[model samples]
Target: MQATLMIYNGTAAPDADVLRTGGVPLAPARTTWPMCGNTCGGPMQFFAHLPVDYGVLSVFVCQNDPGACDTHDPVSGANRVLLFPSAELVPVAVPEEGVTLLPAVSAITTAVVTLEPEEADEDGLPPDAYDLARGGWKWEPGELFGKQREVLGSLGGSPSCLGDDRLPECPSCSGVMEFAAHLEEGIDRRSAMNLGGDLGYVFVCRPCSQGAFLRD
Candidate 1:
């Protein structure tokens, strides 16, 4: 997969039938050796399955030995993000190499919802990507029957945490790594990943094909 920095606009949590950490893949994967962790030296655990404007995006992470992997380094081999054209997509079975599949619950159906587009300026200039993702969080919920929840569909830039300038540094070069994506707890209480109430931050050093995962 060509490495690119991307931010997808979706529900704060992942959606149904979407691949997630410890969840079985949707269809036959393209290959047997789906993803091998660069640092962990084994198959990486699936973390998310996202459908974007182009196609599907799959995210994986290696928590085999978190601290030992130096997850703060983008090329530490602890994490990976892949994008694929829907037509060419193939699903993979979970590797039976002693990898633990963390517990996840059934996906929640939040209900019908509509998202308000990010506001434009008097000149009709589109809002900045960072600003849109940061602000989109507040507009996600509404009173359904009585509970406040998000409607299904892309909400545009629902970044879990931003503006803290907590970007990680590359362990190899000591250079500042680039922010890549934000991972949240699953759509609700049932399917939430074991992030300990922290959002997962992904970073990458494209030239090195190395990635890192962090939580804050």
Candidate 2:
């Protein structure tokens, strides 16, 4: 079976929820300015806002000490991921004067491709989330899998596989960093964050406000 490519151009609408996988992350109410755990004392940069079955997952990374904070450690304080329950979801609040909550939002260009089962299992690749997603889409499993989207929130509350299981160590604290996000090419296939048509892994050291990007 051959693969087919489908594209969706995401539009930027102020004060609107981005239904796609890639877009500015919106925060829940009552949360303070997403402060960097480092010395930045400023709001972290908004990454992606993914809608999952349980709720919306908002991701943010610190841009202040980009060189120091180990962006790979979950407890590094350089990045933050917040999961808001769907039932208790609230409107995103605006930041006070002079306090910036996030950078400018950008339109997303979603790139999706259908992976036939025959093509997905090539080379005896182990059954993983990607395989499950493709299977769910082709087999028409209702509720058990639901409609599979190109950009997924997170797989089983964990980062999707990127060909390897090795987690990098923090550059600053020397601790093993945590898998933060899995970024796939969404726009122009050739121009997606230089991922080279492979999955991108985002590792973070939360306390360090540092991050590392790797492609597999």
- In order, candidate lDDTs are 0.48, 0.49
User: Which has the greatest TM-score?
Assistant: 1
- Model 2, CA-based lDDT: 0.49
Off by over 4 Å in 1: 1-22, 26-29, 32-39, 105-181, 187-190, 202-214
Worst 10 residues of 2 by lDDT: 1-10
- Name the lDDT value of residue 35 in candidate 2: 72
TM-score (all chains, Cα) for each model:
0.52, 0.50
Write model 1 residue lDDT over 1-216, tens digit each, in one string.
011222222333323444233354433345454444555587766665655444455556665665555444335556655545566445465677744344553332222233355577788765554433333434545622421122112222433434445665666676676555555555556445545555566555555544456666
Cα displacement (angstroms), candidate 2, residue 69, comes to 2.0
Error of 2 at 102 (Å): 6.3
Compose the digit string of candidate 2's lDDT tens values, residues 1-216.
221212234445544565343333455556654677766666765555545444555666565545455444545676666655545445455344322333333344333434444433576654454434433543453466533433432332234454334566677898876665565545443223223355545566666645555445
Write down the worst ten-residue block by lDDT for model 1.
146-155
Q: How many clashing pairs per prediction, in order?
A: 7, 22
